[model samples]
Target: MDHLGSWRFLKVFLPAVFALHHFCHAETAPYYSFVQEATSAPLVSYYDYIIVGGGTAGCPLAATLSESANVLILERGGSPYLDPINKTDKENFFLPLLDPSPHSYAQAFVSEDGVYNHQARVLGGASVFNAGFYSHAETDFIKEAGLDGSLVNDSYLWVEKKVAFKSPVLQWQSAVRDGLLEAGVLPFNGFTYGHINGTKIGASIFDMDGHRHSAADLLEYADPMKIKIYLHATVPKIMLITEIGSRPRAEGVIFEDALGVRHTAFLTKDSESEIILSAGTIGSTQLLMLSGIGPAHQLEALGIQVVMNQPMVGQGMADNPLNGLFIPSPLPVEVSLVSLVGITQFGSYIEAGSGLNLAPSLVQWISKSLVTILNQTEAKVNSSSLLGARLKVGIIIEKVNGPISTGHLELQSTNPNDMPKVMFNYFQAPEDLRKCVQGMETLINVVNSKAFSKFRYPTISTQDLLNLVATLPLNLRPRHLNTATSLEQYCLDTVMTIWHYHGGCHVGKVVDQDFRVLGVDDLRVIDSSTFNFSPGTNPQATVMMLGRYMGIKIQQDRHS
Candidate 1:
């Protein structure tokens, strides 16, 4: 055939083959139907509601809202469905954490006190990146939050059906459960979701087949035509219109796409049309402060025009503190995330997991954490020393249900791209330290129990343990060495965030009971930031429940 004739023939042939392939594989395609690239979004769009941050809370809230009204979700990151390396494969789970590319799913951040943390910059938010441990908040926490009992209860079911799953009990997890019961964390609750005061096997996002069902799965609830999800869309500011004496109102938002093209999205003429910030803890608080709904002094310092002098916008941030004991196992254990939890009498939650091959980035992180804990110079200890072995079991002791010693978030500058300054003032309160100490003691007791003996091979001697604990950076070490004091100091030095950061724009202070941002018209925060207090559990389940409840509440209010 001639060159021109051949070119025309190839065009016709390629598309036919492509279409045939797509048709054959249609059933295997990812389930997100309404998502679009940021560049594809219209330059000027209108919606009844605009949800910033297509994350754990934002995804569900947007899906629910779309059932009643048009909704727009502007996410700063790409879709997890598009990134199989980071989102789908269980063996390559840590790839996202190790990735430092501009488009990496996990955006790394550091706390002011030097602890490192990462936040998900994907459509499913942290739900795509977390360990997938699912647990409901304690009954006491529900009552404390003043949430409607029935609504909270029903909301869990709504989220659970979409994302939660029962993780199979493996060898390591079974041993941990037995050890917890042996340690007096009695009343084994088998394969339940309730966060009761006893050892329990809970639901997980990772299923038996090892595929994670993230909160993004909840997008199935959205009305496809009514929902517009734009990935890689960064909202810089919430546009507001104000009068001399009248309060400020959010009219729209200005966002930038991946190609650096700017666009605007506005609310409908309806007075009830609203803007919701579901940008997790840090992102939501940062966006609020950037949009002038933060401390007067802080905003003024950054030269950001103040919309409202809400001092509490970036204050009262809290993170669940975690300390763990690593047990080297001679036998290989199944690769798993959180499945079994021990709710101790001393106000701590104990969970166990196995089979994590630490990524290079995590190894570096462990080295830094060890340096801080041991008060040693960088040369003395390296990442290899901490994570040399494979086949290791981790006993994670978390001070989930304990005293809430909060922290604060501060803006580095007016730039939205610049990371915010986070200060999780862990162990600041006397009660918080006491709780951590008690939790550490409980972990020691559990490890020493005969139930754990079968798996625990004397990896480190008692003297070595004492020496390791004695080298902790905490100044207040007992003059005469003892296991109790050593463990307490180790906890003080080694405690890190479990990634359960909450309460920046909390209820009563930043937002109202209904989640409306205080003093701001037509705006609300419905993420972890809106949490009144940290629920004493893994927090993903509670956050999703809150998202569902808020979504339903908004729908009800609109109808009424």
Candidate 2:
């Protein structure tokens, strides 16, 4: 057989034998065999590509690229297994990973300044715990982030197909949606299953049967060999192989396993190879600073030798602003921040996969159907327009502006567990604050509409402002309210993080528009960090799209 023919034959033959052996020899102590597994074929001195972090973006990129090249995806987490957190059918994957669990491999990182940082030491990375809601920027958001709109949109559509996101198909409890609609917040987007005006959807996950799903669900069905997952691993540093090019080329990555054993994986041994950093905003920025690719002054403070003096490595931080509107609901419904789960009652999810548990209903129920609908009519509004960032399908506002220019992430120590210093400078911009105030007003108006007139909800007037004053911090209170008539008070009271963190390594602010770290070659970042601003809604879909686009680029470069 030719090389291609032989490879295809073994792909089928080996899996069948392995499956039989696993079932029949279930009790056999770790079966030893002379046949080398596919993954162990070679610790090649060089690889065509090395992608760090097998997450929302990483997995798709790694899997797609492996079609033609020897791709090495080094995840801090181990391979995917059937665990509650990683289960294909489970929608509550947002359960935190800080605790010990078979489904997740967790780790922590401290800032070099001994101040602040957070890290995930899992295989799927953030995807293992995210709500699985998928969303993209309005046209304006991309422009604000200084990205090419056409390129971003084209890239987005490509990944959306790969991930196969379906609208929620279940009958989510109507209390939230009904209440919002009564309040005049017409379902923000008819296309957005749950998106209401000023509200966001919960989960964008769809099941294998082409229904509402979760990250675990989609990932579980993906071909295993084509995308090998390495969980419970922590990437400590990136090894740089400086070449004669204008920028220093990244050679490989060094990571530590759960057992504390250290190993080195390379991108290209001798010939030039590309390194893609799919680590989240926080993880990627920290890794870059640690490897001497960040601000010269900050690296010097940590006493690290500088390789590339890119000052914007950890600047321009952005995150979706979240505000909760609680109306009295008499129903005994379980609150799930990550996803809706009521459709299982009718067995619609298990049977025909239609009902309250359907993906569209769940999302509509959570976000009240704001973003999904607006995006359809408000196509003229780009990413920067108020509607684009303020109104999206997910329960988050993807609004952002240039943050305090001085903010940066720096390493506190060389220890991998040390968390990096994080400075969000949230609400530092007057425009951002103004948007929040306006968005809050719009939200309250929708809640008071006739469609949601039931529930006897009190209109959020100046009189009710006193009741929420306590929610704001003591120091920030003065800025929030005085007469209580100003919507700013309500905005400050309910404002929170949608947990869609990005822009730490934003384009122009940190990495270039191509997502490459300035002065660094073969190292591209295609994670949340690459966004100069936050996505208008759930960033999972956008991040995945970025991965798809970057994966193609990696392949092109490798062949060249």
Candidate 3:
């Protein structure tokens, strides 16, 4: 057998894991392994490609590239298994986001705008904690990104077969679907994965049994011998070489294992060897700034060496502005997570999630926000008082499109663990607010529809429903739509996140259409971070596709 064939055959029988954990032992013994602790890696290693952030995009990217090259993945967090937070059962859907541990799969951060959001620290990235709704990137999105339409479709197919599944619509979701149709959202598209303008039962990354299949599962598609992933490996900076006549080029990365031991992973001598950052919106931008590739002034301010003086590294920060109402179900509703959606003529997408199991702390956490929002001094609030007895409530939400409003991320300290100061300035743009208002109007119609009468109060008028939301602490969510605050203020006041935030290393500003950093060579940012807009209602599907799409492009580039 050829060397490649021999390696492949050898890995099958030789224990799928490598335990040569010591730096010295690993350095001397070259072997094949999968999903190893960072401690198992050598102090110094080389690869044809190195991907930072073994996340939604990173997993597929590393997997695809491994077909013809050796790849190393450095992830800042631990495995997604053996933790209640990472459990895929529908009942535990929100556990990952609510996990109190500082080192859990999801890391909570309050944006400068004071909006609570999450960053995924686990290997699978945010896909591990997300709603699991799957949708395709709009055709307009494909064209806007200058991607090959055919390749985009094929990439979507590749991801769908691996992760996407038919969403099982239960009672609450069925009522939601009927309500959307009755509300005149448009001709129903039925069950589909397409990004369309109508009510549709799209796909889900969760299987029929409720087991979540995240991007990490895509690693199985990789060439076993050519891929090595290090969990709990934090990359502090990208190593760059600045030649007098040439642009700055990324050569490797400096990462620290869980033990705080530093190590270097360099690229092979091949001219095509590249370093890609699949770290999400915040991580990719933060790493770029930390590695001296962002605003020179900002870098210098943080005591970081400026390499490229790229001023737009952390610019164009934005998130979909979400507004929703919590309706206390009069009857028991089956547990579901956004199984039905209503795409309005306006730029908003309306979706619903049912049987939300909100814990007392989560209820209190949200109640605190509500208590402050209600200026009435006499308004007393507690979890039980706000939610009554059961925390089970149906959440109906709409996200405005083209939040066109933009913000920037500023590094506070040089510390990699310290979250960047980000303010998406949600609904700063007039269009986003208009869309939110319109979307909310349609959502009210859905609630008032006859099909949903079973769940909502029969006597409750639209205004009464709004008043009802005001009473729920979870309803106390960005959403404070006061102009007394931008555009009516309700959007800003109630605007919570469905967690679909993108931009930072955006196309045209930070990276080229090919996702290569504009001022650097052999370094690429390949995540939703590079997107100018969040594609469709969900970006995870597209994020996963991008990894496969670009992996093919990069492999093709090597051949050329």
Give the TM-scores of the predictions, in the order they appear.
0.88, 0.68, 0.88
Cα deviation at 426, candidate 1, in Å, is 0.8
RMSD of each: 5.1, 12.7, 8.2
| CA lDDT scores, all candidates in order | 0.78, 0.51, 0.81
Clash pairs of candidate 1? none
Q: Distance from true position, residue 219, model 2, in Å? A: 6.1
User: Model 1, residue 40: what's the lDDT?
Assistant: 91
lDDT of 1 by residue, 83-118 (tens): 543345454566677678988888987788666688
Residue-by-residue lDDT tens digits, candidate 3, 21-107: 333333212233588989888999999999999999999999999999999999998776535322655667877787879788899
Worst 10 residues of 2 by lDDT: 345-354
Q: What digit string (tens of lDDT, one per residue) describes model 2 on residues 1-560?
A: 99999999999999998787567533221222211222343333356777777776776677667666666666655433333322433333323433435434444332222222235555455555544555565566566656555666676666555444544533222334443444344433434422223333333554433222322223433434444444555677888867665567787877665667666777655354678888787778888888888879888987877888877787765554444343322122232233321111111100011111223333333333223322434233232221221122112122222222224465678665665666555455656566656545544544454443443223333233233332323123234344345555554444444455676677765667777776677787878887655553456766766676666666666578
